[model samples]
Target: MGISVTHKKLKVELVGFRLSTPKHYKIDGVENIDIERYDHEIFSKYLSILLEQENVEIKKKIDNCSITLLDYSENEISSYAFGKLLVFKSGKRQRIVNEDDLTEGEFKNRDQGLKNEIHFVINKTTGVILVERDYEKIFKASLLNSFFYHNKNFIYDYVDEFNKLNYNKETKTSIEIHKNKLIYINPLPSQDLFDELEEFARIKRFKVTKKVEKKKNHGIDGCAKELEDILNKASNTSLGQNVVSIEYYMDERGKGLEMDSLKKMIQNIYQSHYYEDFIITGTNIDNDLKTLTKDNITKRFEFKIPVDIDGNYVDICILFDKLLFLIQEYIEEHFDLDDYYSDKVRNLIVNP
Candidate 1:
């Protein structure tokens, strides 16, 4: 007797109030919708309708929703499950096709459609709502909960005060205020109010140095030496340092020589000293030879130079630690220090 292997088909269960449009709306139906189409307005409208019908009120508006997706072939399994629900509910089969019927490109397109469909159902279940009204309240509540949960010392200290002000007008005004303080929303700040709050929080008293150190040298050699010194100092501290140096050489009278020099310098750096993990710095980075030489030896090297910010023509390399302690410090100083650093360190450790 021959041994037989039987593969089990995956079953995806999606539960929500079914959307009943006034008229039949064809949504490219898993065969024609591309990834772009899934992100388009039509798909979002479809999602909004499904959400509305399901009585799901999301705290945030459903302007866009990101969904996890599986392979195109797997869509058939989900569709089959959906079809089963439709049949059970309405005594009819939902139109679906097997994966083998479509070409490779078509399969991807179909997969996008499947993702959109699944997202539509999920959005409905999650309860789509506007961010201004619902999400703001939810977010404030979540923040207070988090503050209470983590800051046990503060919570204990202010427990009586917190309880007394829990529902009071003044407390409500302060606590429920949106964008009155910095509000971080993933990649960007939530609003201009949040940005203003960030700026306000960043305001601090600065003490002026009585003596400013004047550089004796002001060219490429000076810049390079200065970079080396900074790296040396950083290495002396807990932060470890790595140096990536670029040197640009050009004769005074050549046309298009500066760009060519930069290109050659970059190529040389890439070919010879391309440290997978290191700080980058450059020499002979300005129009004036004397200035370039002096800068190379005397200036404390920065990851980003003033010239770069001003969009001036210059050759430059950045010197930084392999561990990115400086970058980490910058994030901490400028953003939600603890939370941001913890997340970043977690990612670095995991990835490393």
Candidate 2:
């Protein structure tokens, strides 16, 4: 990447120095001595000598360009010695520049003007430099390849795997549909597939009703009052005992309601003069029916088709007592019920 405008200029401090000496000159107190000269070649040679003697590491390089060095601090050197050497080699006539002079905008622009220019920024604490390169073309090429491969194989592989699993025989389960309700008998449907079915029903203008049963252990009066409250709210009017529906979420073992409770509710509904019909609906009917028959409770009602909001079947049990009278009209209008049922069963078996 190209260096940003803000990073074009670099600032460094002269922290140490080394000297080039005649092999036979036995000198004392030579560490603080200042020398003078005035040529680019001489300056470069003297700087190179200091770098070599101090064992400084070349922290950054930019080809026939700038180089920076870092010396071990324990070597005992001073910045004045290095400056003196620079003054001696470059030329006594050259004026000394302050460290702040290195930060001029003109100097930074000059360094950044060339195309494909590289730069480095060093962390003073660690003596490590960050090397920046101009590699826009290379980065763009690799990015294009990544986008193409991800869009092609990555998506297709997932779809293929999903289809294979959907068709596996061991995972298939049949769906049963009755009236407006759909029932899954064997394997349970996954949440994603169920959501799709719900969406389909929503598009078809169907309303879904879910019957939830509140568990009642001993407070029959409280349960009955609560049920009355729910019915009143749903209908926007007070519902008397007789106008209520008693439903249960049944399992294979039995009806979810106790026999005495069911009887008491039914009796209350029949005695109340505020309503006419008292119907009881249950899911998982096989078990419920077995339990009801064992207990000899024989009240019967027509079953309503239970569908999701999208007009898709969710569960098929007994409908409301009113549906039995409308069955003939319903069948007359929907001639493709058999085909629709078949499709639902096939989809459930494959996707569930």
State which candidate has the highest TM-score. 1
Q: What are the models' TM-scores? A: 0.16, 0.14
Q: Scored by Cα lDDT, where does model 2 land?
A: 0.25
Clashes of 1: 28
Candidate 2 lDDT, tens digit per residue, 7-45? 222211111111111111112312221111011222233
Q: What is the lDDT of residue 113 in candidate 2?
A: 21
Candidate 1 all-Cα RMSD: 26.7
lDDT of 1 at 87: 8
**Model 1: residues with Cα > 4 Å off, grouped in runs:** 1-55, 59-97, 103-183, 187-352
| Collision count for each candidate, in order | 28, 14
What TM-score does candidate 2 reach? 0.14
